[model samples]
Every structure is written in C-alpha cells, then in structure tokens.
Target: MKINFALSAFLGIALFASCEKKDDPAAANRTELISEKQWILTAVTVDPALPLNGTLVTNWYAQMDECDKDDIAIFRKNGVYEFNEGASKCDPNAPQTAQTTWSFNSTETVVTVGSSSFTLVELTKDKIIDTRVHTINGINYTFTETWGIKPS
Candidate 1:
C-alpha cells in the first residue's frame, strides 16, 4: 500500500508539471501576431497644441467616410507594409494602395514605418496601440491609434 501511494503521488506531480500553461502569445510571437492578419484602425486620439488644433481634432472622424473607416493595413513578414483604402474611395483620384516599409527597433518598443516611427504602446493577439508625437512650427501634436483585426 505504501509503494502504491508513493507511485500515485509521483504520477500526480508529473501530470501537474506537464499541464503548465504555455508562454504568453504576445511575448513569444509578436511578429506573427502583427503580420498574420490585416489590421483596421478602430479609434484615434489626436492632441495638437496649436490654435487650429481643436478643429483638426474635432473634425478628424468626420473627414473620413464609411469606406475610409474600413481602410486596412497589412504587415508582411518581409518588412513590407501596405495600406489598402477600402472599397469606397476617400479621394477617387488618389491611389488605393499605399505601400511602405516597416521595421521594429532593437528593443522592439518602436515600430518604424518609412520615415516615421511610432512607439508601441500595446500589442496583443486581438489589438494593437501605437502612439506618435510630432512637432511642427513649435507646435506639438500627439496621435494615438488603436487597431484590430478585420472582422471575418
């Protein structure tokens, strides 16, 4: 009976160890998470420190139509980034595809796209948040954008 009890305890401990949770998805596969699906901008916050900044911030959403809201961004594993303007055109004369290049900084805290770079605020399986600050003519503007995978 003693041997049987000891064996059972050992088996239980082994089972528990094997059932440990896996590594975090974000930490293990950030690039895969960011590149696997097309991300659409869900929300944007803009803060500008200029006289006309208020109007720009207030009228930001109104400036984009329904189709503009559906614009999707694709991040390729090869470091190519493409922005597809949705079916409806914001400007009929403008090109639909905006191709660019992207790369993560050494620490992976910043994502650089072409000449601009954004601080990666948050990255998860279903959501991403990036923030950017720009200074123009002594005026500072900060923009924060949240993106999510496109619905099936």
Candidate 2:
C-alpha cells in the first residue's frame, strides 16, 4: 500500500513538471505573422530617372507594361530573383539574377539581408509593402514593391 502511494505521488509530480504554459502574446503574434510561411516578390517599382537604361534597359521597359504578366520579373521564396530570365521581354540573350536572404524585424517594419535593408512603408492583407533604397558605388536608387505571402 505504501509503495503504491509513493509511485502515484511521483507520477503526479512528473506530469506537473512536464506541462508548460506559453504566456507571451507578442511572441505568438510574431510567430504567427512573420515566421508563418515563405514570401515572393510580386512587383518591383524603380525610380523613373534610373530608367532601366543602358545595361538595365531591358529590366525596366519590359516590366512596365501592365498587361505583360509573363514578362514580369519573378522572385521566388528561395531568395533568388530572376530578371529577364524566362521570357523574351528584354534582352533574352542576357539574363540577370540577384540573390539575398530575407528576414523581418521585431516590429515587422523592415527586412534586411546583407548590407541592404528595406523599410516597410505599408502593408495589405496579401502582401508586405516595402521601399528599397539601394546604393551601388556612389549612386543611390529607390524602389517600391510588394512581397506576396505563400502558405507553407
């Protein structure tokens, strides 16, 4: 009878110790929102002055047409974005691709990868809005775009 009581008490203590309660609401929200799944860049907006001209001529002109969905630059969730890779939009002979990692800040206002950071200017139910200011050498260019979310 004493042995049975000791075993029951030990089991009860083990069960209680194993049970844990999560009390952080912000942490839960971040996990649910930012880390929920993968995202892809659906649209890109570049400075009108830069004008995808010269070497970038193709990157700009073909993407400008609203009816040209096939010619649009496609950025995958894997962090690699393809510009003029598949279609004959710009220079089919010369395709360009850029790669970078993706992450959201604590406030979910900005995303950073390497030396580049995009500030969150707006957001919608389907996408996170961002504006990117890129400085190459001494030249700076700004762009606005929306990143579409994907279900995992």
Candidate 3:
C-alpha cells in the first residue's frame, strides 16, 4: 500500500508540473513576428493641436512624397534594429542607413529603439501599428504609423 501511494503522488506531481505555463507565450510570438519581417511604412496619421492653415490635419500619408513613402525598418532577433530609406532619398544629406538597438517592454506594449520609444497599438503577422507623441512649443502632436511586411 505504501509503495502504491508514493507512486501515485509522484505521478500526480509530474502531471501538474507538465501543465504549467512557461515564459509568456504572447511575448515570444511578438518577438518572432517582429524579427521575421522587414516592415515598410504604409500609412501615417498625424494629429496636432496647432491646425495646418487653420484646418485640422489627419491622414498625412497622402501628402508624403515618393521618397517619404519608401522608408523601411527591420528588427532582428539579436536586438539589432535598422532603418533604410528606399531608392529615393527624402533628404539628400540624410544617412541612408540608421542603426539602433530594440527591445520590448515587460508588458510587450511598448517597443524601444535606441532613444525613441513607440507604443504598440496593434501587431499581427503581417501588420503593425505604433504611435508616438511629442510636445513642441506647447503643441501636442501624436503620430500614428502603420506598417506592413515588405514583399520579397
């Protein structure tokens, strides 16, 4: 009887341990999704307290030039982040390649790349939406950017 009881208890404990959850599954998915693809900017929405010519401005991507629309960013598994301007150059003097380091916050809702931090509004296998807020001259500006996986 004693042998049977000990064996049953051990089996029960082993089963319970096996069912335990490991590291956050969502975080792992986010990391994998972000690292696997090169994201290209698809849309941008900008809201500013100060009106543009006395009119509220939104959906700013329509105003972006071909060069501005060609920016691409990539995050690697090794924590290296890179941004490249496509064939066109938004600024003739701007560096073509921008390198940085990136990591997800504990909650995985924020992504920090070098000195800039972006709030992750939405993320999926093929799409990402992030937002950043800045204050300049007492005017609050919010910029929301949407990116899609670049086609191979």
| All candidates: TM-score | 0.71, 0.43, 0.75
Residue range 7-109, candidate 3, lDDT tens digits: 1111110000111133646433677767747777787677763355566667666656677666677787898877777678757887887776788777677
Q: lDDT at 45 for candidate 1?
A: 56
Q: Could you tell which candidate, 1 or 2, scores higher by lDDT?
A: 1
Q: Number of clashes in every candidate structure?
A: 0, 2, 0
Best by TM-score: 3
Against the unseen true structure, what C-alpha lDDT does each candidate score? 0.57, 0.39, 0.61
The regions of model 2 sitting more than 4 angstroms off are: 1-31, 54-107, 136-138, 150-152
Choose 2 or 3, whichever is better by TM-score: 3
Per lDDT, what order, best first?
3, 1, 2
Residues 24-125 of candidate 2: C-alpha lDDT, one tens digit per residue: 442333223333334444555556445333445213323443322333233335544333222333344443433334545566556554344557665443
Pairs that collide in candidate 3 are none
Candidate 1 lDDT, tens digit per residue, 1-152?
01121111111100001111236443545666677577776765557622343344433333434766777777788988777766776577757777777777766667776666677777776788776665656766665667788898
Candidate 1 collision pairs: none
Question: How many residue pairs of model 1 clash at the backbone?
Answer: 0
| Candidate 1 least-lDDT 10 residues | 9-18
Which numbered prediction scores highest in lDDT against the true structure?
A: 3
User: Once superposed on the true structure, which residue ranges of model 1 sit more than 4 Å away at CA?
Assistant: 1-26, 48-63
